[model samples]
Target: MVVTVPRVSGQVRDALAAAALAVCAAVAAAVWPEVRPLDAPGLLLLAGVHAPLAVLRRWPGRALASLVVLALPYHLLQYQHHALVPAEVIALFGYAVLGRRVRVVLSVVALLLLTCVVGMAMRAGGGSVREQIAVIEGVVAIAIAVQVWRSHRARVAAITERAERAERTREQEARRRVAEERLRIARDLHDLLAHSITLIGVQAGAAAHLVRGDRPVDRGELGEALASIAATCRDARTELRGTLQVLRGADGGPPEVLPGIAGIAGLAEAARAAGLTVVLDDEGAGTPPPEVGVAAYRIVQEALTNVVKHAAATTVEVGLARDGDRLAVRVADDGRGPAGGSPRGFGLLGMIERARSVGGTLDAGPRAGGGFTVTALLPVADVGSVTPR
Candidate 1:
């Protein structure tokens, strides 16, 4: 199959470059004395000087070799005909760009120096010594210019390559962080909806049953169930709204009042509303930093939610205390836990990840006597925040 190249930036650059070479060649040939006819040998020699430029960018070394052989004979045979022979000088520039080969460049410079010498000797009868010296000076100036231009081009190419690599690295890092944020949001929503809705479902189902029972219904019991349902829904709504705002990114205003060690009492109240009595004890020094506070709040919240869902217990004790540099939190329910001392679900996994994010640790298992317990130790440092989705 034949391949076609699309006109990308690099291809466009090459086209502009080829056009520039064509212009240079035409200018070089245009200034010669009375132009030779298309059929004359002089015109053929002119083609040898100008035609190789068409491929100079693609094959600079070969073009330099060819231009040297062609321009040498033309200079020696017709030194007095044109004021300047540009082909050999232009070839030096092409070789400068396409190579780091010092030997090849030096050889070409020596060849051009030889041409200037031979041309001056041949024209000694007509041109003065000063004029001959001036010609050699111009050739030396051109050689120095080619060397300087080549060094600058090499430096620019190296710097450009380094810049491109850095840009690519930044893009890759941004993509990776985005993927991690999306995953965190997915997990937070899962925990919030799964645990909150389960409690709401239980309370709502109980309220529905009592109102429609065969026997005379107790107004107080039905009232408590309905109240619990309402409270759960309110908590879910508030938490979901705050989480969405966090996901949208922070606006420079007062931070949302998130759950922390102080919020454990509120969480206990919520659990108590769901028909379980929860007791809370606080022994920490000052308020924990927002990160430690938030992780502590989530740990307690998740544990109590588990108690309501699976514990089938009557009372839960929530405790918070500062142990040296760590804020330790514990939630123990006097109800039967899973026989294996572990819950096979993302709930425990989310709790563990939360603790780890804040440079903390968590342990949960069945108590020796009866119920289950979740204990966590959170560091009060700038490890990271466990921000909700």
Candidate 2:
């Protein structure tokens, strides 16, 4: 098993520093006696080489080479029983493991072991041959362990990085799918609820007109109004049920048919039936794109809905014109309001955002003469090309 420095909290780095210094001092003590009977000062100077080895990872190749170079002076002095085996062995392991320099590590190991063997033979020291062999074996084991540990660490780091990147990618894709689902649901609600309400408004007006001159009330007309209302309610309930299923994590249903300019006349007819007089003046020469047609439909829908809710006006005007390359749509209501005053609510804001989504501009404010006006300008065609509905 390989021994690594644990990433512990509080006093760990300081503790490691002290432990390494102590270990180096102990090694120096054992090797000091071997180089006695020679200049004590020179041997002390040579032992100081181990100081740089403590910071080996900070400068691996330089420290390893420096340790070997410092050992040469003791050999030249012919110091008694001087052994460079321990320092050279540790330096080789450091180079191999942390520095990952296999060639340099092997070369250093062979050179140092050969020097120790030759020196032992030349000196005729009293130390047992078994003890020297044991030291060589220990160093070889350490070098092998360090090599294995380094390889494992590199593989682990690579796997962790790839996993994290994949996780992020998956999260982004999930969010995008969720957002598209919400937009689909919104479009569905607009189609079903809006269509059903406009139908109810039409039937209600017809029933009210048929019984208007009756002495009390026509039971037949009342029954027809109630029947129409029930059908509208049933249709809304069916559409809302499907929307609720999607919200509860079910796969969404089919797309709903959105209204375009063809439906705008129906919208005007609905308003006229609901006791509001609507006059449409369409002056555009060219056919409008589908997106622009949809925008025009929605603008009129919102304007009429607001008139039903807030405006007590009897007459409204919707105008459409092609001004050069742009399609201009305007809805003006003769409702009670000061000219140039702001209207409350997100109704206008919603209209503006819808226009902007299709690369268009929208403005809504009180007209100078009487009531409120909403005007929008959209591109006649996107890049001179039209998208089919």
Candidate 3:
């Protein structure tokens, strides 16, 4: 088993570091031959230099300033200068890494100049040139390293932000696709059930009327009505099964062939069976892309369904014509429009969505002459040429 170490807080870590540095400085002052003995004043000065380190990260500039102020007094009082050098180095590192660049540069330059002047004054004979050069070189090297580290940290932060943004975008795109698929499935279900059930209901109602009449029941007509119901149910079951298989992504069989514009005749025939006179006028509209074909077929189907359910008139005219790259489909009924002002159902919305999905447009409204009409304009050219709405 692997062992996990508990994390240490920054404040606790800083306090421990400051305590260790103070102890080491005290030990060095007591043992080192070059250092003077620690007096009460000298011990106080040492504490002042190292104690600020505990809060260095929280207040880098202030801690650095405190170290400089105490260090000057320690040096001027002739205390062991080497004992507190480590603390001064730690303070300088905190300021270089955490303080603003402009402020750090100014503070470091002022401190270095002050140190050089003080050293020169302390040595009446003047200090060695090599020692001054070494000190300046060390400070410059530290500054360069700090700047490189800061640059690397900034780059890492930027890269992480971009990755997070990309992940969010991908998630949003996935949700949009899922929503569209759900809507497509809902439309399919509505069209299949609405058309088949309405026809079956009409056939069943006719058979009931025959049986309930005072005269003897017409067995021949009743048999035909029952057969029609059976046929409609079988077709609905097959289509539903195919839809489910497609949704399951089963590779056991070939994909189901969706009905296209050519299948509009079947829609008209079915409507006629339900007692509405349907007129289909096909003006040699050439074959369209699969998406456009499917969209056209569904739009016509939904328009017919709306008429059967809401329109009271007996006849509906479905016209198809081709003009250049456009395919026009119109479904007109000599019936009253929606009982109310306009249609308030998913059928109309589904038809509109289907047309728009294939970069087409559909309009439904009451005709001035009297009746409801749905007109759709579909592009017969390559689907890629049209921008989806």
Candidates in order, TM-scores: namely 0.65, 0.57, 0.78
27-112 per-residue lDDT for model 1 (tens digits) = 55455332232224545565666666666777877777776676555544443223334655666776787756844574666667
Off by over 4 Å in 1: 1-58, 62-84, 100-133, 147-188, 209-215, 244-256, 275-279, 310-317, 332-345, 363-373, 382-389
Evaluated at residue 132, the lDDT of candidate 2 is 50
- The segments of candidate 2 whose C-alpha lies over 4 angstroms from its true place after superposition are 1-47, 51-170, 173-177, 180-184, 187-214, 218-257, 283-285, 337-340, 383-389
Error of 3 at 307 (Å): 1.1
lDDT value, residue 49 of candidate 1: 61
lDDT of 3 at 203: 77
lDDT of each: 0.73, 0.65, 0.79
**Per-residue CA lDDT of candidate 3, range 205-272, in tens?**
87888889999988997898788788878877877787787788878878677778888888888788
Q: Which candidate order results from sorting by lDDT in descending order? A: 3, 1, 2
lDDT of 2 by residue, 181-267 (tens): 665456546645665676577677767777786577878757867676676577567656755665665655664444567767767
Give the distance in Å from residue 232's predicted Cα in candidate 1 to where it truly belongs.
2.2
TM-score, cand. 3 vs. native: 0.78
Q: Which stretch of 10 consecutive residues in model 2 shows the poorest summed lDDT? A: 75-84
For model 1, what is the C-alpha lDDT against the true structure? Answer: 0.73
When sorted by TM-score, best at the front, the candidate numbers are 3, 1, 2
